[model samples]
Target chain A: MKLTIIGVGLIGGSIALKLREKHFVDYIYGVDYSEQHLREAKELEIIDEASPLENAVKNSDLIIVAIPVDSAKKNLESVLALINDQQTVMDVGSTKSGIVQAANLHKNRNRFVAFHPMWGTENSGPKSAISDSFTGRAGVICDKEDSAPDALKMVEQVAEHLEMNLLYMDAESHDVHTAYISHISHITSYALANTVLEKEREEDTIFQLASSGFSSTVRLAKSHPEMWVPIFRQNKENVLDVLNEHITQLRKFKSALEKDNYEYLEELIRNANKIRGILK
Target chain B: MKLTIIGVGLIGGSIALKLREKHFVDYIYGVDYSEQHLREAKELEIIDEASPLENAVKNSDLIIVAIPVDSAKKNLESVLALINDQQTVMDVGSTKSGIVQAANLHKNRNRFVAFHPMWGTENSGPKSAISDSFTGRAGVICDKEDSAPDALKMVEQVAEHLEMNLLYMDAESHDVHTAYISHISHITSYALANTVLEKEREEDTIFQLASSGFSSTVRLAKSHPEMWVPIFRQNKENVLDVLNEHITQLRKFKSALEKDNYEYLEELIRNANKIRGILK
Candidate 1:
């Protein structure tokens, strides 16, 4: 298949490389607004050529719209408008509801597949792309029924080639679940980093004494603002819902600690420990 | 030299194993309140023998009070009462102010060294012991002047053998710094895990959708409450202070998201990204 990846950055570049490595993609065309990213993608051999968005779309069998959620929502609609019925289009945004809803009434709606392969790091850009980015992680296909069977099959093949376990859910449910599990983690980490930075002005002390635990918990704080600020904004309601609950939990802990109620704090921690059984 | 580890749990057990592996000690005596732990320590070869607290302290050239912070404060007192001037004593508790205060006016006060090694995992017990547990991490020796020069030298020897970088600070500062850097991380993790569990009732959804980011942030929540509850109790003031600051930060993110203030959200995340420089 001739694959064209719009916004050839981390997610798009990784998929293009993985698909090519597996011999599933005959040729990959990269389309990125940033001249630097387009050049880097080609230089890194993530794509066979860097082409204009219109030229990339006209010549490719499969088009992958991989970008930030807010941008992806706008680009997905524009891409859908230009793609023929035979050419399959897909997006790998962290969010699904916005992009999916944006294309709800598109003429070639069935040609588009909405996928979110649930794996990422605090890093971004083409340099951060790696071949095994999707291995052993969940690849979510949102609202599969809305897509043509051929479009869905192509995405399924991509997921299989990358060794991801494919899961199907509607866009609404996908948004809610990800807000519960993924997006809130980044927000919490960012807040935590800010908290430590604000309260402890001596960076050297925090640097020397920080355990592996502190580093891991604050790891997401290093994520790029260009990606996360939009995510929090796009998924505002769901993010706010979880953030409110998270704040309530934190306040409960604060109250218990303030009251010297070690028993209450102990109970909260014990309840939290149940996540071990749930997660691992 | 003869070495005695009074609490054969994670920190103490790992120290015994690492020291034994390095051939730093002629013999190790394991002392614990739990008979099962003593047996496990011997079974794991973490110690040459499981002996009574008094017997262990009486025979060993160096005694390590590797117990809970609250318990270490009491045990340090009684152990100092039993030890001769030639016998050196040190502790591996998370907090130092309480332990240091308990040994304040003891006749053998000079014999005890206060140390808190900056490494741990969610797992515990003698079975969790491993070689090189403290390698490349900071091992703090608090209030070095309060300890006799010989006693400080013995603890310094153990740190070198375990390949830990020894850092020195007064007990009060150590307690305050740890609360900001280490203790607060665990509390935030526990609260985050509880928030997810309380709001997201479907355990399977949380399990399947949770990314590495979520898992990393909440990993410390699985810490054994027996170990953490006491630390929080003993360091209540500092822990509470950090928790309050953390909550305030959380509220800032919550307010931004609720009000659809992307600019404020962006600023908060940008500030958070500063941790990247500090941590790395």
Candidate 2:
């Protein structure tokens, strides 16, 4: 199969590397608005060639939209305008509702399958791409029934080849779940980083005392703002709902600590410990 | 050197294993109120023998108090009563203020050097101990000037054997810096884990959508609460201050998203991105 991955940065470039390594694709083409990224992707061997978006879309058997969420909607709309019944279109954006709604009215909407592979690192760009990036991670396919059977099967085949577990949900449900599990984590990390950086003016102290726990909690703060700001904006309502609840939880902990309610604080931590079951 | 480790759990047991493997100690003695942990520590070969606290302290040349922060104070107080000028004593607690303050007026104060290694994992107990855990991590030694020269030299030798960087700071400074960097991260993680676990009731959805970002952000939540609760209690004021600032930052982000202020949100994230520099 010939695959054309749009916005060949971290996610797209990683997928290209994996597909080529697994012998799942004969050739990989890349499309990027940034000429620098396109050149970097080629230099990194993430794609065999770089071409215009239209040229890549028209020639490839599979087209992957792996840009930021808002840009993904625009690109998906354009792909929907040009795609035929035979070529499969898929997106690996964090937000699903906007992209799904944007492509809903297209005549070739059946050719598009919305997917979110639950795997990423704090780094980005073509330089950060690694082979086998999505192995053993969950690949969520939203509203699989809306896509053509061949399109769905082709995406599932790629997922299986990459050793991913396939999960299905509606677009709205996908957005809601991601807001709680994934999106909120980024916001909290960014906020926590800002909190420490703002209040702890003594940068030397932060560097000196930073333990493994602090490093783990603040790891997500290093994520690219360009990638996450649009995600929070696109999924505004769900993100807001969870953000409010998170703040409320923090306030409760603060008050409990202030009142020296050790028992209540212990119970709260015990409840949080339940996450161990779900994580592993 | 004969070494005795009080509280034969994660930190204590790991130290014993590393010292034993390196042949730095002739015999390693374990002392814990919990008989089960002592047995487990012996079974895991973290310690050569299990004995009563006083017996272990008397027989060993070096005594390492690695108990919970709350228990650390009383344990140090008792150990100070029994310790002589020849027996050097040290602690591996998270917070330093309480322990240092409690041991200040003791006759054997010069023999007790307060230290906390800036290394740990989310797991706990004897089973969680790793043989080479402290290598390459910073080991903060508080109020080294107060410790006798021989005692400080002995503790520095142990840090050298483990290949840990030894940093010296006063007790109050250590507690404040740790609260800003280490303690706040655990609180943020626990609150984040609870926020998601509470909002996303469906375990499957959380399991499917959880990316490396979410897992890394909440990784500290898997930490043992019995070990953490006392640390929080010991560092209550500073933790609360950082917690308040963290909540304020999150609220700023929440309002930004609520009003769709993408520019402000982007700038906030850009500021958070500066942490990458310090962390790396």
Report clash pairs, candidate 1.
Answer: none
Write candidate 2's Cα lDDT for A1-280 as tens digits.
8999998998999889988988999888898988999999999999999999888888889999999998888778788777788999999999999999988878898999999999888899999998888888889999998999999999998888778889999999989999998899999899989988987888877886788888888998999988999899999999999999999889878988999999999998998899998998
TM of each candidate vs. truth: 0.98, 0.98
Tens digit of per-residue lDDT, candidate 1, span B30-51: 9998999999999899999999
For model 2, how does the per-residue alpha-carbon lDDT over B1-280 read when each residue is reduced to its tens digit? 8999998888998888888888889899999988899999989988889998889899999999998989989889889888889999999999999998898978789999999999999888899999788988889999999999999999998898888988899999888888888898888888999999888888877877688888898888888779888999999999999999999999999889877899999999999999999989
lDDT for model 1 comes to: 0.89
Residue pairs clashing, model 2: none
lDDT of 1 at B160: 95
Q: Candidate 2 at residue A198, lDDT?
A: 84
lDDT of 1 by residue, A31-141 (tens): 888889988998999988989888889888999988888888888877887878789998888888888898887888999999999988998889989999889989999
Stretches of model 1 off by over 4 angstroms after superposition: none
